[model samples]
Target: MGSAFPRLHVITDARPGRDALGVVTAAVSAAIGYQTPDALAVQVRVEDDVTDRAAYEFGLAVARICRPAGVMFLVNDRLDVAVAVDADGAHVGADDLPVPAARAVLGPAAVLGATCREPVSARAAVAAGATYLGVGPAFRTSTKAGLPEPLGAAGVAAVAEAVGSAPVIAIGGVSVDEVGELRARGAYGVAVVGALAVAADPEATTTALLKALA
Candidate 1:
């Protein structure tokens, strides 16, 4: 109904080696090569085994590029890491720290996003304090390995209904062909990982995804 955040979260397609400092930086640099920073939200999930110090260092490197483009750094499940690196925001999941706790950690102005698989999850997220809600795995995909069962358009609608005034992002196995249908279903934006990250031309791939959204 009113202005909220825009869509376009491009998940990092690769995982950094457990202890390799260069791994995260290289992966992010490659992503920068794929798409303009501000044009897309770059969501990174630093492996659990990595130390907060390492994650912070990696985020700093990412910010060097992302901050320039006005691109948002969406750290998954690491509120402190986001704060430490001055990230644009933090995206958490149902299983992670609840939205209220995350928001409290980030302060009121910080962006906080939560993953919602069903209507209930969506409602709880907003009630707790998420600035936005991420809903899906709209279709099956390998990127989110071992995620919950897929929630197609129907699930998307349920989340949207719960969102009411908040923006909702549809993530998971979305492809070029599905963009129109997904957007038509009320998704405020789309998130992808392997689809664009694995493509031969990331720039072209990103152009196509943006076009799909339009």
Candidate 2:
């Protein structure tokens, strides 16, 4: 509620052998360089097997990187780590805490995000105090397994229209090239893991993403 939620979310790729912190740092630096730090948000998402202590340490580092740069920092599926690290807020998915519960943990004034794949869920999430809606597999993604088939743009539009003004952030397989199409289809923004996490030049990729959003 302090400021509008960011349009471009750089979700940490904590897959085995990936440098989550390094990717977050690079993304933050890129946001700062563009002089639109506030337009980018960093979400720290580690594997379920990751201990709370490890998640906290990582979230703390990301918060440190994002705070001074004016970028919002959120922890995924770990409200404890979010509160422990004093993150801007937390993001909750189906298997995680409910939107109301997450909002309760973060309290008022914190940015709360909830994942919803369809219109009914999207409306319910917004009604339950979600600050934004993470809606997708707008396209295919290998980052997370066991997801239903990609929603594509039409599915995202249905969710977006249902939620009204609540920002709909299209996730899964999001890339710079698809940003415009997603936005045109009523996606307020996008959340990405592979696009930047595996990029040869994160800064350039970030720049392209921001430009596409614009």
Candidate 3:
């Protein structure tokens, strides 16, 4: 799964006119049809208010959607759900489980992702067994609240440099237009939420995002 990181990662979210699972299906279907499933990973993330049962069901559905296509399916901040659903792994933020704890829960083979905004945290995350880093709020975003200031492209570059071999995935307010800039700045890839969730045509939007990365 070395090539699995540094690819397009779609994080699920619900907003007006957007069915999170629907958008995920469309985006993933498009990626599979375009022969880029290997370049896609979907993280099952719902609002904090959602019940664990609901998140677990959603994770199962996403796993079913991704498994056949060989796309990695991950649960956000839910190690139990990830394990129960047999997902590829789990993604954790600063407020969620600590890196080593998450690694412990998921064990050595699971793909553990950690969020990092600066060099020190990036190093700590890597040392704690994070397979990859989600470095962001690359630009201001509404998808997540109380995020620190946006880390622009240069900020992303700095974190990427600090992380060395570990993949740095830029997140928060990332759009198709910003993918190239992020990649050029040494970001392995991006984790998107609002951009595709609210898109009028998510399939086409996914296609455009992949093209940009290409």
Candidate 4:
């Protein structure tokens, strides 16, 4: 899982007239075609209103799509669903299970991602067994409401430096254009949502992102 960190992380979201699974599948398919399957990972994150059963079903479908391709599939904030679907891991935020509790549930073999906005929390999360830290909004984001201010490159670097070897995934409103700066600032990788979801050409966008990461 540590080796899997710092790769491109594509988070899925269901939007009007758009198929979340379709977008994720397309992006992952394109990514694997462009690079090694390990070069990309997908996190299945639907609306909060969607039921646990629905989430589990979605996770299963995504896992099926990703596993065969060698891409890691994770469920956002749903440990139960992740386990039920045999997902590679789970991503938990501040309001979700504490890092220790999450690690306890997923065990050492599974990947556990914790969200952090600053250095102190970053260190704490790593201490609690978080495999990686999602630190952001690296830029202004409209995907999630009530997010704190963006943690520009310097903020991301501070957290990365604080956590030492733990990978820092710059999340929130990330774009392909910011990849170089983030890599230069010590960010291990990025987690993107709206960028690929709304892109006119998702496969092309996925290729561009992978190229930047390369």
Best by lDDT: 2
Instruction: Give the TM-score of each candidate.
Output: 0.85, 0.97, 0.95, 0.96
- Separately for all candidates shown, the number of backbone clashes (residues 3 or more apart, or on different chains) is 0, 0, 0, 0
TM-score of model 2 (CA atoms): 0.97
Rank by TM-score, highest first: 2, 4, 3, 1
Q: lDDT, candidate 3, residue 118?
A: 93
TM-score pick, better of 2 and 3: 2
| Candidate 2 residue lDDT tens string, 1-214 | 1266689999999888887788888887787788788889999999889888988888887888888888988988989898999888889999998888888889998889999999998899999999999998999999988999999999999999998999999999999988988999999999999998789988889888988887
lDDT of 4 by residue, 1-214 (tens): 2255537899987656767888888887787688667778899887788899888888888887888787888888989998999888999999999999999999899989999999998899999899989999999989888889898999999999999989889998898999999999998888899889889888888888888988
Displacement of the residue 82 alpha carbon in candidate 2, Å:
0.7
Off by over 4 Å in 2: none
Report RMSD for candidate 2: 1.3
Q: Please give the TM-score that candidate 1 achieves against the real structure.
A: 0.85
Better of 1 and 4 by lDDT: 4
Which tens-of-lDDT digit does each residue in 38-136 have in candidate 1? Answer: 446677676678788877877776677566655676788888888888887899986788888888888898778998887887888888889888888
Off by over 4 Å in 4: 1-6
Clashing pairs in 3: none
Residue 124 of model 4: what lDDT?
Answer: 90
In candidate 4, what residue range of length 10 has the lowest lDDT sum? 1-10
Highest TM-score against the true fold, candidate: 2
User: RMSD in angstroms, candidate 1?
Assistant: 4.1
